[model samples]
Target: NYCTPYLGYPYYSSHDEMIHNLYHNDDCMPMRGFYRWHIQDPICFDEDLKVTIQQIGVGYRGLFERQDDVASVAYWYQAEPHNRFPKLPDKEERWPR
Candidate 1:
């Protein structure tokens, strides 16, 4: 025979209270659960040019999913120009077409 309380444990604790107080006082962006493991070499950007592939519409969603896949990232990077944003140069100018 086993006995368990339906109420379970207390909802609020000292640590939780402290954390909530501190959070309310500070202006900080709460951490998100979205994360990706790096599987390829980091993409190097030119400081002078400062050109980046900014995705428009629903394109950003695919970027996070392909963060670990080198081939996919490359493909996306190359396809950036042709996307709805079309920030990058023409397809013929870039590699991995």
Candidate 2:
């Protein structure tokens, strides 16, 4: 998705005033930002769905598998009559520390 970096531009521009640069060290080498492609590329699934991401990088040596710490969150929309989501405990009970 690098080719279509979602900067919230009018078209396909790289004007990044929408998203904050979470990590951008070494001349945009090890760059990382919160990317959203739901508008541009919406995926449609019928029944079940699974999401996965791979850390791949390209450098002077070319494309290679990368090992990086990654964190992600996913949200989905369902049709009507869907099963209700289980209720969660209070914040104090959920995050007892």
Candidate 3:
């Protein structure tokens, strides 16, 4: 399970479950995604966790799933073992008013 399962918010604990729920079900998705660097960046609960990360997507039941402003992150598969990266801190560390 990846999601921490805190607060009243509901989340899939496993990667497969999360992906299945997000893509297979309309009731569960167009789910919101955010970064929590100060606390945690949504790490996987599994002991053999390697690439710890959370993924978010956009789209709703209609043509446009999300009706309001939302945040997102993108990852491009650049040539393996390359240096130089962009600076993107956790949602809180970057900006907050």
Q: Give the TM-scores of the predictions, in the order they appear.
A: 0.16, 0.46, 0.21
Candidate 3 local lDDT, 10-64, one digit each (tens): 4432233444556654553344443334233544352343443343445464343
Candidate 2 lDDT over 1-97, as tens digits, reads 2445654323333344445665532233233555466866878888688876887989899999988656666677767998898898878897525
Candidate 1 or 2, higher TM-score?
A: 2
Top lDDT hit:
2
Over all chains combined, what TM-score does candidate 1 have?
0.16
Model 2: residue 88 alpha-carbon error in angstroms: 8.9
Q: List the residue pairs that clash in candidate 3.
A: 1-13, 2-13, 59-65, 60-65
- List ranges where model 1 is wrong by over 4 Å: 1-32, 37-41, 48-97
Q: In terms of TM-score, which candidate is stronger, 1 or 3? A: 3
Evaluate model 2: give its lDDT: 0.62
lDDT of 1 by residue, 5-77 (tens): 4212223222433356665644543322222323365445543323344433336455332222122223223
Local distance difference test, candidate 1: 0.38
Worst 10 residues of 2 by lDDT: 24-33
Please report, as a residue range, the 10-residue window in candidate 1 with the lowest summed lDDT. Answer: 67-76
Whole-model lDDT values for every prediction = 0.38, 0.62, 0.45
* Selected candidate, larger lDDT, 2 vs 3: 2
